[model samples]
Target: MASTSTSATSKDSPEPSPDVRVWLGNRQAVEEVTDHERLAAMTDTELAQQGEPKVRRAIPMKKACTFLNIPGGTPLLEGVGTVVKAWPHMSDASAPAWVASTSGAYASLLAEHFGGVEVREPEDPDVMHGPYTTDTAAVAGETKGKG
Candidate 1:
C-alpha cells in the first residue's frame, strides 16, 4: 500500500516578488507612454498633477546592454545603442515615437537591444517607437566581445 497526502503550502501561492515590485515602482516613476495626442497634450504641470513627467527621460545604452547582455562582437560594437526620450503629450499622438542612433558595426545590434524595432532614417523627426537622444559613445570604450 502506498500512502499519499496533499496540502496547500503558503509558498505555493502566487505572490509579487521584489523584482516585480521594483520594476513596477520604476515604471510608475516615469510617465505613462501612449500614442494618443489628446492624452499626451496635457501640459507638464498637468502631467505633474497626475504624478508623472510629460516626457520620460531616455534609458541609456550602457544600462540597456547590461539588461540585455549582448556580446561586443554584435553589430552594436560597444557604445552602440539607443537612448529613448519620451515624447511630450504623445508628440505623434496617434503613434509612439523615440529617437535612437549609434555609430559602429551594430545598427542591427542597437535595433535588437530595442526589441527589433526598425531603425529609423535620419531627416525624419517622427520616429515611431525607436531609440531617442544622443550620447558620445565609441567602440574602444565597449567591453570586448563576449556572450
Candidate 2:
C-alpha cells in the first residue's frame, strides 16, 4: 500500500514554485528607465551631434564705453567694476533721467537715445534701470501733462 506523509520544510528549503504566467506577465509589465547619470555619461561631442538639449542663443554684450561717449581708443577695463551713472530710457533728449551703475555711461546713452528710464542695480550697479512700471506711467503722464 502506498502511503502519503506531510512534513514541515527546513529553514533553508527552496521556496514554492512560481507561476510562469504571472512571471511572464510581470516581465511584460516591467518598464525601462533612463536617468540623469546615463544622460551625463554622454560625451559633449555626442551631445552636440545628437542635439539632445537645446542650445541658448547668446545676447550681444552691452558696451558701456560706447554709451559713455568714450572714444574707442580709450582703455577703460577699469570701469567694468565701477558704478557709472546712466539713464537708458529717457524720452526727452535734453532732460534725460539718470541712475547709478557700473555701466553708467551706457545706461545714460540709452536714456538719451531710447528714453526708457534710469536703472540702478545696487548689487550689480552696471545694470540698466528705470523702465520701471511706475516710472513708465509717471513719465508718460508727465509728457501728457506737459502737453
Candidate 3:
C-alpha cells in the first residue's frame, strides 16, 4: 500500500476576503461607494500617496452643532451662510481638523482656535426666524374669565 500526504502552499489559494464598502462625502451627502474607479476618482493626492489610504467625510450640520454646543437651527448670514470650513487644530497636536459653519451665530464654535472675526448679518434681516413670541396673554385672559 502506498501512503500519500498533502500540504497546503501558496499554490493552494485561500478564500478571498469580502470587498469593503467605502463611504465618501462631498457638500451634499454621504454615500457608500464600491467601485475602485469611482474611489480613485474621489481620492485626492494626499490620500492616494498613503500605503493604507483613509477618507474623512464631512459631518452633518446638526451633529457639528451638537458637538460644539450650538443651536442646530441657527440661521447663517447670507453670502457667508451654509459654508463649512475645516482646518487643522493648531493648539492640539493630536486633534483632528475642526469643522464649523461660516455663520456668525456659530462664531463662538471656532473662537478658541481662530481669532473672533466679525461676520456680516444676512442682507435680508427678515430671512431669519424672529425671536419666540407666543399668545400667553390670550391664555391668561381665558383662564381669568373662566375663573
lDDT of 3 by residue, 6-107 (tens): 121234556432211101011222212234554566557645674333333333432111111112222222211212221211111222123333243344
Question: What's the ranking of the predictions by lDDT, best on top?
Answer: 1, 2, 3
The backbone clash count of each candidate, in order, is 9, 22, 0
Candidate 1 ranges with C-alpha deviation above 4 Å: 1-76, 81-104, 127-147
For residues 61-139, could you state the per-residue lDDT of candidate 1 as single tens digits? 3211111122233322322432222212112222222223322223334455446545444333432222322212223
TM-score of each: 0.25, 0.18, 0.18
Error of 3 at 104 (Å): 4.8
Which segments of candidate 3 are over 4 A away from where they belong?
A: 1-85, 89-105, 122-147
All candidates' lDDT scores?
A: 0.28, 0.27, 0.24
How much is 13 displaced in model 2, in angstroms?
Answer: 90
- Best-performing candidate as measured by lDDT: 1
Can you give the lDDT of residue 48 in candidate 3? 62
lDDT tens digits, residue span 103-136, model 2 = 3443344344434555443343332331221111
